[model samples]
Target: MLELNFATSMNDAMSDTMIKENPFSSQPTTSAFTEESTYQAVCKSAVASAIFAVLGLSAFLAQMFMLLPILGIVFALLALKAIRAYPDELVGKGAAKFGLLLSAVCLIGSGAMHSFIYATEVPEGYRRISFAELKPSSRGTDAQGFPKRAAELDGEKVFIKGYVRPPSGKQYGLKSFIMVGDFGDCCFGGDPAITDVVAIKIQSDDTVNYGYGLRRIGGTFRLNPSTAASDEEEIPRVFYEIEADHVR
Candidate 1:
């Protein structure tokens, strides 16, 4: 009878041990190791940092769209929080910090660049000229005439009105040039094409879906005429074109 009692006691002890060892026991699984939480935090930080870095860069390039950096900074702060909470993920933490630093640098650089660009006065040689004053039928009456006019009006800041014409193919669809003169079948008996057009070279992010119509661009007049045939496609000859401080 004593042997039987001993055996029963031993069995009860073993059962209790087994229950404690089981993962499904009452004890919380996450109570022991925090590796899972650390991994999650690291992932979050890395993603946030990458996002901020991209946004900050975008804002810096497009002076008009300056709000991108502000949002980037906000995201960077979130990334910093995640990194601080999970120091075990040192790589992620470092990335987040770097992103924040980059954002700050880009923001400051963008502001400085914008101030410098806008504050600089138009050179006396690059003043604005009125398109109405240009005589299309005169002796200098060629595609190059407008550009010469631009050079003459260099310091005389003026506003020019024109329409945006879409390019031919799908690949060139995004490229639209500003036409200073009329846009019917022909302008002054010349073919109505973008050949003599002033290419606006808008940034990729700028909206280009505005319908073809009269739009005014105001900026310091600058002449960028190209004599080389190969360089013709890249830069237009007559740049009565505005460096566009404002487009209305």
Candidate 2:
């Protein structure tokens, strides 16, 4: 009789426990189902790193865009440090790693490609020079003469970049065209201003098509000796000219 009573009590206790745990009966279940995740919040920096890494692909466009990868690396490092400090609270280790990988690839690849292009850009036997070197001395010269640096380079083979000013006669099948130093001067039509223009006569049978932007020319640099002559009226309209061996 006592054993039967004990068995009945045990059955009642089991039923009570089940009733308390029934979710449909307005009772609490195990903490697993009801509790919110403790570490569900993602590390914000890690997200930012992933985003920046995607944008880092722009590095292929130009050398200046390498900044994107640099920023991605920085953000990724910060995210990893934060996650390490709060492992249980934050997530996104994968995002951080991805950011690191892509950023490194872009930074290194762009740097190498640009370096190669630069090393090979200027053809052999040609020295690169900008318009800055060809300008006349601001401190005043002998009758508005070009700087001494320009005189030294005269008759020497040189490489320079300048805009192809719109030709007055023909756009295509041009044997020669006037080149200007500044983009504004070429597009908006600035005066030739003696020091600002370079007359380019392509040496090869390759006649150039007129276009905008800087033209890369490698050839013999010429200084119109008439500019330095005693008579101001003897000065040529364009003070510099190039018998271009290469035009791009």
Candidate 3:
């Protein structure tokens, strides 16, 4: 009887412990919930880093603002730390790796872009001029209404800023192309006025890739009355042309 009582007591204790644990219950434990939250945070960081990396590589958008790549790299590192901390709970390991790669690429690209922009510095003794000032007025537009400053710039070495459009659809190392004042309008297929565009002819046989943002070009300025030829309806062919000596 004593032996049977001891066995019964041990069975009762085991049953009580099992009841408390409640393996059949569907509710998640506090630890499980905490782990899920951690996983989500890790994924969010990874995704954010990836997005920023892509933005950093964007043509003009990232070029003007250098922070995108830096932030992307930072976030990617954070994501990696989180994933390593909770490997069992956190997902998106692949995403974190991809984010890191993209951020690195953008960082490299941004550096190159900065170097290029600095290289295109305007030479001393060149007067700065706007595209609007360079264009002579058409019949519908009055040349007298335009700024007299453009006339003064004629036959002078001038420095101008504009966005480049590759005539050959080449993104890098353009030997010849057109420049426009507004990048937003150009991207949306909006044609700029004749005065707002300039034909750029690079004399160097060594081609340079299209620069991001507003590029400063220094060269000889000439005013001539001629109609521009364009295969695209959105682009006007009539405008002032610049014989570019140096482009940055």
Q: Which one wins on TM-score?
A: 2
**What is the C-alpha local distance difference test score of each model?**
0.54, 0.79, 0.70
lDDT of 1 by residue, 1-248 (tens): 99999999999999998877887777756646565656543556456655776677865555544666665667667767765665666446566667777777778889998788545533333333345554343435445554344456654555565655433333233433555455552123334433344444443444344444455555555455542222234333443444554344
Error of 2 at 141 (Å): 5.9
- For residue 89, model 1's alpha carbon misses the true position, in angstroms, by 14
**Prediction-by-prediction clash tally:** 10, 0, 5
Better of 1 and 2 by lDDT: 2
Instruction: Count backbone overlaps in model 3.
Output: 5
The residue-level lDDT of candidate 1 at 104 comes to 78
User: lDDT tens digits, residues 18-60, model 3?
Assistant: 8769989687878888877765444788888888877877633
Order the candidate numbers by lDDT, best to worst.
Answer: 2, 3, 1
Q: Which residue pairs in candidate 1 have backbone atoms (N, alpha carbon, C) closer than 3 angstroms, thus clashing?
A: 125-154, 125-155, 126-154, 126-155, 127-154, 127-155, 127-156, 128-156, 128-157, 128-158
User: What digit string (tens of lDDT, one per residue) describes model 2 on residues 1-248?
Assistant: 99999999999999998798666776445675546545367999999888888999988766667999999999999999999998977999999999989998999998998799778878898988888777776644444466777777788999988887777657898778777778777778566576767788889987777776457889998887664321122224666778899987
RMSD of each: 12.7, 8.2, 7.5
Lowest summed lDDT window (length 10), candidate 2: 227-236
* Model 1, C-alpha of 11: deviation from truth (Å): 1.7
